[model samples]
Target: MTDTFKHRGLRQKLVETVKAKGIQSEPVLKALGKIPRHLFMDSGFLDHAYQDKAFPIAADQTISQPYTVAFQTELLEIKKGDKVLEIGTGSGYQTAVLCELGARVYSIERQQELFKKTSKFLPKLGYRAKKLIFGDGYKGLPEEAPFDSIIVTAGAPFVPKALLKQLKIGGRIVIPVGDDVQTMTLIIRKGQKEFEKHDYGEFRFVPLLEDKN
Candidate 1:
């Protein structure tokens, strides 16, 4: 939980790198710079933590590149106090970012090991989600229906209906859909049964598992 001047400097550089790559959301950039990405990674790979690339974390998942996190977050168009649902809580980095942006985050992680580790680690880093659940992301948090925004961090073959249904009308969902090279898709709930879809670009991510096996 030690964020030294060096860490802060690296984060500032990381922010500039992400900004140069076209992430214009000031809030998102600020959150990115504020979070200590190295704390979310293994000490052995600490040097690579702020390099704007995804690195392996526990449960065979990657922490996600800073740019991707920023891109998905910006697509959500988060507002202060917005209720956000995060489908994957891998390193809790994105959770920290959303929390930094003043969103109430409800995060789910299917891998018990990563879930347990992150659940304990996040609070130590002073980033707390509104609720951290251990369950299948595909089913989503139906009891906490109608989120202001939902973000799926993994690549799914198709959009989960449960996630779409759990969003508030006019809420937005940012998910990567595809088995191989996933397309970053943004879906806005226009009405009870109407939604608008926008595709950003391609990205490669680990598969989104189901059933909490």
Candidate 2:
């Protein structure tokens, strides 16, 4: 692969865009800068891969818009070597970002084609995960219980109870919650019985569903 990101214009734009929008986390910006988004998208989309808008990938799914990805990633407040569980892997773009932030990622994708295909792309992007599961993400990764952070890519009716259970104390979960016109929410598990929820703002996303394929 070429060093396409070195001295790239998009990286500069990402820095400016996130900064203008109040994305305060430096590591999140660094990951956005370093990741070559063009590689993850269809060749036809190479021209717009680095833009802030979401674009279609395989299986009728779109890569998360760069701003949304940055917003959610920053909400996690991650440090080095955190264990993150990602529900709704989609194009694996957000999964790659979490991995870049020094998280041991375990990503679950509901679409069989997306899971099968992105399973290979992860390595190509230079990120390793505990596993990429082809399953209903609503259930989460039970075998790998207790994630330091959990991020859900799709919009759900509410934070899944199982997911809240899996978050270790002080762990943060960023999710999109609603049936229509979802709001991006951050859920912090403070203890075995207490959790705090914060809503960032309205967002439109494909609804989170329960199915393996």
Candidate 3:
């Protein structure tokens, strides 16, 4: 619960590190700077909190690397008050960034342990999403579909068709599609049945598990 001046300084440095890597979105960078990432992890890992890398968290999930979070969030081009769907609420770090940007975030986490922990933890830090459900990320959140944007935090072997159908016309999804390694993919909805796709190089992430709920 303590975010000291030292921690703030470290976060600013981390922000600059992410910026140096080509993350130019001011709003996204500002949100990253504001959130206390160290507080999201256990105190034992406090020393590594502000570094530009992911670290293990509960339930074997890693809080995403800061650069990866920034890259995906920047690609989404989040606008204030946009309805954003986040798949994989691991550590609630990405969800906090979305909240800081004023997006109405609906996040789904399949791991019950992480879900319960995060559901209770996020509000304590004042990063409250619109909803946090313990369910299969593969299914997306159809009941609350037509999101302005969707972000999948884990690697998927292929883009789930259900997620593609959940976007509003002109909306976009930023997902990493692959197996052991992933190709960051961005798909933008053009019309009722049209989508524009782009890939942004390679990265690794925990696999997005399906149907284990």
Candidate 4:
């Protein structure tokens, strides 16, 4: 429960590192710098927490690398107060980043342990989502449909139709789609039945499991 000057300094370095890697969104970088990433992991990994790397957390899931998080977030083009659906809560690091940008996040996690852990832990760190649900992310949250943006933090074999259907027209979705390796993908909803897809390159991520509650 400690965020010190040392941590902040290390985080600044991490932000610089991500900036060198082409994550130019100032808001995203500010969020990266503000969140105490070390606090999201077990204390045992504190030394590696701000190293721009992804580390495993509870339930066999890995927190995304800082660059990846920034990349996805930058793609969403989030605006303040936008309703955003996050498809994997993992360590809640990305959730905090979204909150930092003033987005109203509705996050879902397939792993029950992670959902319980992150849902409770985020508030202690001064971050909170609009809703945190333990459910299959593939299904999205139908009742809360039409998000201004949606982000999938894990590797999906394919884009789920439900997620696309849940976006507000002109909204964007940033995701990594594939199995062993994923291509960072962005889909912008142009109209009622039109979407524009773009790929930003490759990344590796844990599989996004489906149909599990």
lDDT, candidates in the order shown: 0.95, 0.87, 0.96, 0.95
How many pairs collide in each candidate, listed in order?
Answer: 0, 0, 0, 0
- Residue 3 shift from truth in candidate 3, angstroms: 0.6
| lDDT by residue (tens digit), candidate 1, 1-213 | 689999999999999999999999999999999988999999999899889899999888999999999999999999999999999999999999999999999999999999999999999988889999999999999999889999999999999999999999999999999988999999999999999999999999999989756
- Tell me each candidate's TM-score: 0.98, 0.95, 0.99, 0.98
Off by over 4 Å in 1: none
Instruction: Give candidate 4's TM-score.
Output: 0.98
lDDT of model number 3:
0.96
lDDT of 1 at 208: 97
lDDT of 2 by residue, 89-153 (tens): 89888988988899899998989889988999889868888789988888998889889999999
**Model 1 TM-score, all chains together:** 0.98
lDDT of 4 by residue, 1-213 (tens): 989999999999999999999988999999999999999999899999999899989988999999999999999999999999999999999999999999999999999889899989999988979999989999999999889999999999999999999999999999999989999999999999999999999999999998665
